[model samples]
Target: MTAHRFRSLLGGLALACAAALPAAAQNFPDRPIRLIVPFGPGGGTDLIARIVAERAGAALGQQMVVENRPGGGATVGIVALVQSRPDGYTLAVCPPICATAQSLYNPPPFNAERDLAPVTSPAELPLVLVVPRSLNVTDARGLLAAARVRQGGLSFASPGAGSSGHLAAEVFHRASGTQMVHVPYRSGAAALTDIVAGRVDFYFDTVASALAQIRAGEVVALGVTGTARVPQLPDVPTMGEAGVQGFDFPSPRLRVVAPAGTPAAILARLNAAFTTALADPALQARIQDAGGKAAGGTAEETRAELNEEAGRFGRLIREIGITAE
Candidate 1:
């Protein structure tokens, strides 16, 4: 064929494929969708993912399969998500790890902002500041006073150096004008164990993880890290309300995301399905039961929130000089 003819043929094919893109998106999820949970099964993220998957799948007329790909500080699943084809078949329940992974890793394996597209946030978890029952501190003010007197002798336990709990404690320290030694552990459960044993001074743990302990009198709830009091712990004062001004730490948000470059139509469909699931009164109640608030918003809102959180945690992680193991 002549060169001009060949070029014209290529252009025709390109136009045909572009026309088919929306048609394909309209019939998205002809099969089961893979939903990656970056954390191990049974954790709050996984539980929430399962709940949303069940509801969203029904709404989408497909099954949303929950696949646990836990590792690398929740990066393993995210990397898988980023590498997946941007056809909306593969999505992930992006946790706070998405915001902290870049700062935690010396060189991040995946750039969350560049590699992933936010769909919608399904829920937000509030962190509670708890101390061992043996501690004499009654409120956040007393805790700050004790820290001041201890003069770096006081220590706080966290799941790891760059975990949400760790960063929350750092934010609290900056707000309270106090210092505390950081005690890192392999897992939140391990950190909580030490806190209950009085080996660690305090912990800013998720309300889900620490609620049982607090109810059982194993740990004393000093304050919560949220703008307002959590319903489950209504009596617990917020970090700001407890006297730590400008002390709203980042919460563990449950967001859905797809690979970057995914068609806008596909993304919109996915967001609508998930948001509809999130809006279900039963789903909201289930999320509340699981120690999170059902939060569904536009993809743009989710993206903006993620960007803000990434910046906030990045600064705190750098200031604290925390490096992942």
Candidate 2:
């Protein structure tokens, strides 16, 4: 072929590739996409994961299959998704647990900062400090004094290491200036159970996970782990508002992260689909009705929040002298 003809063909090929990007993105979900939930069914993580997966799947014209892989403090599911091909077929629907585990664990194969690209963090489910109704401590100040008086006598639990429970307790130690025995469990629901039974002195758990017990008065909400009082629980102040300047640990947030290196077009499409799906009034209502919050935003927004929290969690853990189990 003539040189001019060859150049024309190359230009046409580039144009074709560029033009096909949107359609290529739309062509995704040719098969069922796996929305891996790193927790057992019936927990808050499962509830939100299924809700978002179903709604987000509908928006994409593909079935979002939720697979529950509850182990290794939720690292099992997150690592699996990270290692999978980044064709946008495998996605992780997890919470802050993944980030916490990544930081607290002794050695993590998957680098959250590098391997898992943020898609979005739909909403934050702030963890609440709950004690048995019978516990003497009723607020952050009281809890701190109680910890001091107990003299390393109290015990606390998290679903596992690197979970909100573990990290929140770590922060409390800094504010209160004491350490509590750390108990590890496979699930937050399990830890909440022992707290209600008085087998454990206290637990910092997601509001959704501790809702039932808190309502039944089996546990009392001392304060939330945010900067302000949760609107839903107006009676409870945030850890900072409650006078613990260094004790702000939000609950396990539901985050959507795709494997790194997915096409930018595909990532944009997926991000749009997620934001649109979560913003729907009906979907938001459904989440609230189920006792959860729906948070949706741009990929960059989620990344910023995660980055901030990782630094905060890292510093708090080091100050408290807690190590990954």
Q: Which of the numbered candidates is closest to the native, going by highest lDDT?
A: 1
lDDT against the true structure, each candidate:
0.87, 0.78
| Residues 232-264, model 1: lDDT tens digits | 889998887888887867567888999999999
Which clashing pairs does model 1 show?
none
Lowest summed lDDT window (length 10), candidate 1: 243-252
Query: What clash count goes with each model?
Result: 0, 1
Check candidate 2 and list the clashing pairs: 122-295
Error of model 2, residue 22, in angstroms: 3.1
- Candidate RMSDs in Å, in order, are 1.7, 3.1
Q: Write the per-residue lDDT of candidate 2 for residues 92-198, one digit (tens) a residue.
A: 98676555555566676577788887888766677788887777678878777777778656788887766677777877865676767888876787888888888
Model 2 collision count: 1
